[model samples]
Target: MASPITPSTGLGSGLAIGDIVTALVNSDKLAKQTQITTQTKLVTTKLSGIGTLKSALSAFQTLIKPPVGTTSKLQFAGYSATSSDTTKLTVTSDNTAVPGTYSVKINNIATSSSVGTAAFSGGSTSAIPSGALTISQNGNSKSYTIPTGATLASVVKQINADTSTTNISANIITDDKGSRLVLGSTITGAGSEITTTSDITGFTIGKTDKLDATSATSAGYIGSVPASASVTINGLAVTSTSNTLAKTLGGVSLTLLPGSDNSTTTVTVATNTDGLKSSLQSFIDSYNAVVGAVSTVTKATVSDTADATTGSTVTPAALTGDSMPRSILSAIRNELVSTGAGGDLSVLSQLGITTGQSDGKLTLDSTKFQAAMDKGLAGNVQQLFSGTGDGSNGLLARMNAAITPYTQTGGIFDTRTTSLNKQQSDLQDQQAALDLRVTTLTATLTAKYNAMDLIVGQLKASATSITSFFDSLNASKS
Candidate 1:
């Protein structure tokens, strides 16, 4: 491809036309071509570094935000709940819970009503008079027809599977006494009692088989009569139609287990110190991750032994001398150590979260953190990460505010990345144009060298013909 004539082409020109043309063209292209290659790789590396930094910033923001939209668990003053007598009641606490112990006497747990029809002496297939039966619960009712030859089990099955009956469930209990249809309500509130009636004379789901709990065993007793739950929080005698109580304590929920009346229990709600520690630990870990990521991009290093063993030279991060990484570290440090006026717990240091070794990474001192917890997170953990007004004055909020811009669409990272990508595009365009020019110039030079070889071959043939003419003349003279 270099030239039409070559030494291997049997031409007597004695010139390496192909090699000469190629060398000239290559010499003209080497400088600009190398610049394009090196620039492309450098730009790509910078873009990747920016992408990693943005990811770190986004993760730190997620850790700072509320885990759920409903509650600010990250900003909660943690609570621990305990029931002194768990046999009668169980308890749990929520955010904004207060610390207190109160006497709780579960006068009665709410119960759902149930009624059973008169027992049939014959087998479960015993037929009943044709009639209309209506079952009602929780303001919903369903009607069913009792056919002329319907058995006891068929009637029970029909009532149990009716779609219109929302809160009532029916079953046929066939004990030694015989089979009786039992109807119970799904809810325990006062108005949730299940009721039933039938047009057939002397045949209805009535309370004929109600268990007297006071005199019956646990196995024989079933809940009847929809009654409101009764409990005394701090001897205040609160009443509820549901067994689960949430307003009994300032920050706890109490679930009533079935038990006899007149049983007294004690309930306590207090701060969960370990839980508080775990929540704070999240911030420490996330902060450390961001710090490590940024450090790798700004001030990476290697040990002397590793460098010597691997023959690897020291090459700092691309962003090492850039103001962006420096400013990023400085801004986060400012927020981590910043405090509010007259605030109980303002800075991260108050919660025993601190950084060391000239790096922006965070560390939690357990001993100091325990001491802070002893002082109730130096008063309130809520006001620590969330301020007294609007929650914008705390460490978490400030850090979020500082870091949010960097990851947004038009922030510093976006601008810098856009610029780098443009540079990469420009270099690629330059390389393409330069390569086309080199190709064209090489072709032109090869064409010119090929013509020169043809001319030299023609001149050599002319000289050979002249020498033969002289030799023939001398032979004629001899």
Candidate 2:
């Protein structure tokens, strides 16, 4: 097929059969090309959607991610310069602390726990252990089998072994022969009462039978109470319940210990997180999806070929060219891999997302990736994707922002669509003009040919009759 010609080449200067055929073939080619170009533009639009969605996700993730391992560490502003030497500094967190220069030595730090109470002994023989006290809370029940040889420590080991509950400890007060089994509340505001479905046998309930509770009042947060109680801490009259008395004095903050009053304090802090680890994983996921999508567009698969005349299928090799995938890859790489005056920040590799020399595919050193993200990942991620030009910052944001201009009237996409529409309109007008021209040509050719056919047919008829008459005349004359 010949390539389509523009309006300037509509009909050749000289009219001929070859020229007419050429114009038709060229028109078909132009139409196909326009369709392909439009489809490419549409594909770009779809990819923009993918890219923007990813950017939005990245933004949200960047905002909430805690700074490295800082989330796990307890932060207190003020302590007496000589407090470490004078007082015992204890670690409140259960997990082992990371090795670092301590603000104070954690001397004589005791692990947080609850002391369990003694179990009730003896159950009625036919009652199926009914007489023994059963501790029930939140629909979960556990029977205390106080054996003849049962000790408080043995019960504590059993409760600790049960994975269903947390922090259950049992200890004996040997001076009073009173065994106390303490159930530690895994969370704050846990219910106080421990109910029994079975009878309490050989066990006496005392004023201390109730579980010891850690409350907000004991923690010294007096915001709820209006009347100020005078308490002298290090010879300082701390009146307010919520104010940082220690912090006000020489930028020092006090770490308030948990109280045993059973009221949960409003100050609930998050535990330390394994920073950078999770961030690296997310980046990997997004990066892989994009890479895979590009690979799919660039690679080709085998297909059966069709014969031109009979349309029979056969194996045939054909060359196909596609630039969309490569263009997308380029856009992403240019955004991520370029360095700027913002320092040496460029590419995922610098931030620990390395690519191999052989394949040029992204690989992650999780430790490095996490550390970077934890300490300074937000700046790095933004820096990597930021674009060149005055005020066109952040590669993803820049590209997504650029998409709006392409969609506007007379923009690249708009212009192409407009141009294609004009081409189709002009093609239709040309087709209409061709209809008239062909009609005129057909009439003129048909009339001239019909006249010749009619003359030849009549002559043949007359000759046939004349031969017959000649035969008759010959016979008569003879």
Candidate 3:
């Protein structure tokens, strides 16, 4: 028998060999438990990395190989501003925006002018008979009574009605502190000029000449410009009554609005080939960014190469640095540089863009590239990145179509994230069970040790009792 060690210090000699062995075994188990916890975290991170990579790859595939399989198309149109008359509006069919023959209609016309009037004297002078005077025009009538001493202002009031009347409207025009009686025809157009047909008894035109009709009229005109502006559309100079011109050419109609100068307007038409080539270049740029991100996480890393003797694949973690990212980028760069079936340069090199080997970055010779573009080397750059469908095939349209599925109630990303949450919840359940096991094991182990300690104490008392009894018997014999 050995003395057991005190629980606090493990220093007594009453300990069993099994107990020491259990303590050493528990220490090794704890080390393994720590490794398991670290590995669990690594697994979770790898899951997230995989999800992001899938998304990036999906985006890259969609860009590189477009589903529409056709390039984009674009046409131009303009508006006419030759008519000063703002109300001369135009309408079209469909968009009626086509360049065929379209017409405009005029609405709401007007004009203005001034006229002369007579004055009266009081007390029945030679100029007038005094008392009251009547004024009439075009079947309308009004009366004014001349007082014994009527002032110029009083005579003026009779001629200028404060408000509306049947034949014509009358008012006083004032400036600074001075006032002049004015008359205007309520109707529109040049025919609406005001004139006094009848005179009052005491009033006359007088030696003081009447005011000019033009002086009272407004300056601007209401109808469309009498003349039209000349606009040359695709070499066809068109004379339009109004400023707006809608015309069609090559199955597409471009509305030609006379430019602001209203002089010679020049419009340049882009051919279909030019439009398609421009569209293709845009696709290449977008695809490269996404591929680069995915490659960063999927490549081999430094930690993976460590502990190779352990026989495990030692995938310490997925590649996370610049080297792998650039490698993946280079793969995509190689694809773009590969030659197409036709054209002066089969690949992007023909377009004056050369890829660098170290990092897959591109260098553009702008002057040379522009020269190729000018010569139509890109072969309808506009068509490559977009489809010619009416309102259905631009880059935005294609991206929207692809992303629509992910937004649906049961979409892929939604399902995947939900699955991850369920897995994490299950792991939490396992952790709880493990915690209960640990608690129960600690309690049972402590209870067993306490019982063993009590038994050892009992044995020690028994040994002492026996020794004392034997010594007493020997003393008696002596």
Candidate 4:
């Protein structure tokens, strides 16, 4: 069999064969294709709407609910620690910090030891003749041998190179006088004392009480002895190796500012009313958003209707009449208003968060809320939303539990979406099959019409030849 030819246009008998074939195939599949398209469009639209609803619900539940959200850190009250004199000390605290006021007298700030070698004419490049020196701290010692003719910089490097046991840092510091090797303790406090074992006439190398933390570095040996930070808290002595004291008082940390020696500053921690208020407002906003979303999905849509008697249009909500949405919304609304669940501040209304009569959405009265919390309900606010018990026991917890069956993995929405996806895929397959069949039919029609045109042209030529032959014979007889 010959390969079928597809014409450039409707070439068979000039009868627009391609158009006719296309019309036939399209007529055959039109109804079925229309049904599938309509169904897919409706399903997709419904899915989109549900997605919006679910997104809003998930966002609110995850952001505001302590058990289900990152923002659960809101459970811990915020405290602002301020010093009467920030020059003495200004501080920040984590959620663990307990709120209180304490008197702090900084007798002295912590110090680091700064020690150096005696001046040399050549400064940092000056040779540190070959010698073996030992550096000790905290009763542990380590030694390093200087290479012959080592520069002052090279000696500094050798001393600082191995601090695993020496526990001291060395550097070359130079001024107008000359350069010298400076060694400072890696840590602060009396235990961080640095001692050297070496005899060099040009340098004094050893731990000495006379070498304070701020000694001059002009001479061959300038060792600034480290000191522990000392402060008096409530008239009691407190000491720390670091300036920032950790938990010296119950759930409190303090630091001595520079130049606070013999000076006093008071640190006060208190409830951050502004921060708490902002958190509460966030909760209200999330609640409102969820409520609005539910209403959008479930609320009955209204349209105008013609009145039979008065010939006038009357507007009414031709409700979807879907009991599922109504039931879900009604359950949530009832829960919001229901009382006696738990806690003295058991109701959302007590927090000035209440549903509006008209829109069925929630609104927050900031003034009323602030007043309620200020009047001593602040302590119970957490219990009202996030109480201890089963997840459904508290208001916020109830909301979280209610949506879990739909939003969580292997859930209601997941099942519906999966089924819809399969349906869509099946529709696509059917559409592709129809398109292929039409293409095949079109090719068959084109070839058949082309052959028919050739046969018709041949017959017309044969008739013309017969007429010519007959006329020739007639002319001959005449």
Cα-based TM-score, every candidate: 0.67, 0.35, 0.44, 0.61
**What is candidate 1's CA lDDT for residue 176?**
58
Error of 4 at 48 (Å): 3.9
Tens digit of per-residue lDDT, candidate 4, span 249-315: 6545676777888898988877656666777677667767876766666565443766675465642
Candidate 1: list runs displaced more than 4 Å. 1-14, 66-76, 82-95, 98-188, 192-237, 241-244, 254-268, 300-314
lDDT of 1 at 424: 92
lDDT of candidate 1 at residue 44, scale 0 to 100 = 86
- Candidate 2 lDDT trough over 10 residues, lowest sum: 216-225
lDDT of 2 by residue, 1-478 (tens): 9544333422322124344554554564566556555555544544444344334333323332324654412121111122332222112322112222223211111122232333322311211222354554435666666455544455456555663563233333322333334454332222323333334342332222443223211111111112222233434444433222344223234333333121112221122223233444455555555566545444455447666744766422111144444554565556456454254455566557775565445677866755664664433343444434552564444444433344335654455446546665665666566556655666655454456556655776789899999999999999
Candidate 1 per-residue lDDT over residues 1-478, each given as its tens digit? 6554446743767677777878999899889888888789778878888887888888888778645565443535656788887878888776567777888887888887776665565656867789898776666678899988988778877876863436667776665556566666657866665656778643454433354333211122145567888888776878888788887677788899887467888877777787788778877787888888888788856555546534766665767677887778788888776774235666677777778877757788888888877786533776767666786876677888898778777999999999998999999899889989998998999888778778888999999999999999999999
- Residue 292, model 1: lDDT of 84
lDDT of 3 by residue, 1-478 (tens): 8555545532233555356555744664575556546655655765576466556645555554445865322221121122223233322222112233322222212333443333222311213224654444333446667565554455555556533654455444443323334455443333333333223332322222344334322211212212343445445545543343444333323233322333322232333333333433444455545555555565544454446545555354344542533444545554454332323444556556666576454556667667766675543232322334452343334444454444345765466557656766666676676667666666677566657667767877788899999999999999
Off by over 4 Å in 3: 1-39, 54-285, 302-305, 308-368, 377-379, 390-416, 469-478
What is the lDDT of every predicted structure here? 0.74, 0.41, 0.45, 0.68
How far residue 255's Cα lies from its native spot in candidate 2, in Å, is: 25
List clash counts for every candidate, in order: 0, 21, 38, 2
Global lDDT of model 2 = 0.41
lDDT of 2 at 263: 18
**Range of the 10 consecutive residues with the lowest summed lDDT in candidate 3:** 74-83
Model 2 TM-score, all chains together:
0.35
Which model is ahead, 1 or 2, in terms of TM-score?
1
lDDT for 6 in candidate 4 is: 40
